[model samples]
Target: MEKKRTISVSVVNEHGVLSRISGLFAGRGYNIESLTVAPIPESDLSRVTIVTDGDAKVFEQIIKQLHKLIPVLNVVENDDFLEKEMALVKIPIEEDIASIEVLCRAYNGNVANANEKYIIVTVTDKPYRISSFLKAIKKFNPKEMIRSGTVALERY
Candidate 1:
């Protein structure tokens, strides 16, 4: 049986590294559900968070391939980690602001901006919570929304 897994990879900040890493999964007929990459502050390295689903054997192969990459410094699975995703949604300002604010508060979201016609809200939470919040706010008829891929750090 396949199981969902989150992998955190550290790599030397250099050209073509991301392509090479992504290629590894594509070449193997594997799917990356979500991928987020950003530089580690004050360091010449980048952190990549990948969410995927696979069986034990497949995950083993994935880890082995990552280990062989020239610029890959380390690979860690999310046995214990802190993870969060962010989403921005724009809804028509004509909607009831009180209800919208209540819904936002329920999901750790805030009204980030409000104009004459649209209200932009920001929500940061776990992936499932983000999805739930979107569904709950559908009554407001959101005009646009975008969500960030998951980002994580191993527990100390």
Candidate 2:
């Protein structure tokens, strides 16, 4: 069966590291659903968080291959990971601003920017909650929407 998975890889912070890691997935014909990469503070390592949906057996092989990569320092499977996603939606200024702010607050979000033409609302929450927020905000008729896909950290 196919299941969504998140893998966090601690890798050497070097040029082309991202491409090599991504190439590993492409070479295997696996698709990455979302990917986030950032340097680990005060270190020569970066954390790459990848979200993919695929067969368990094939996913395991990918993890094994990740472990074998020379620049890979560590591989963390999705177990006990706290995942969050951020979504930004632009709504027409004609919409009720107060109502939009109230709705955003309910989803742990707030009005991030506003101008003569539109309001940009930002939300950060669990992926599922972000999805709910997007669905709920549809009534406001968003002009543009973009999501910063899943960023995860392991929880002890």
Candidate 3:
């Protein structure tokens, strides 16, 4: 059955690495649902987190192809990792700030900023929790919102 699969790849910090990796998936007709890439702290490496949908066979093929890439160092699947995503939501300040704060608190978030026009609330958590928090706060009508793609690390 097709389902969401999260993969984290460690690769050398080199130009065009992302393009080559992404191109592999594109060339194979796979669609990436979410992708996050950032330099590794104090190291000459980067981490790429990709969320995609496929069955067992297709997912295995992706991992095999990923291993063939010269720059890739390691590949990890979701079950062996911890993941999180962040979202910043700007809601109308005219709406109840107190209630909003409470909701944010429940989701490990807080009012990052408050101005005359809007309140910027930030939440960092599992992707599903972030999605739920956003849905619950829609009554305030988010004026602006941004969500980061999945970032992950090995469970060890």
Q: In candidate 3, which residue ranges exceed 4 Å CA deviation? A: none
When summed lDDT is taken over every stretch of 10 residues in candidate 3, the lowest stretch is 75-84
* Model 2: worst 10 consecutive residues (lDDT sum): 70-79
Considering only N, C-alpha and C atoms within 3 Å, which residue pairs clash in candidate 1? none
Instruction: Give per-model TM-scores.
Output: 0.97, 0.96, 0.96
Residue-level lDDT of model 1, residues 84-131, one tens digit each, is: 899899999899889999888888889999888999999899888999
Model 2: how far residue 106 lies from native, Å: 1.6
The digit string of per-residue lDDT tens for model 2 on 46-89 reads 99999998888989999998998989999999669999999999
**Model 2 stretches with alpha carbons more than 4 Å out:** none
lDDT of 3 at 98: 93
In angstroms, how far off is 101's CA in candidate 1?
Answer: 1.1
What are the RMSDs of all candidates, in order?
A: 0.9, 0.9, 1.0
Q: Give the lowest summed-lDDT range of ten residues in model 1.
A: 77-86
Candidate 3 or 2, higher lDDT? 2
Pick the lDDT winner. Answer: 2
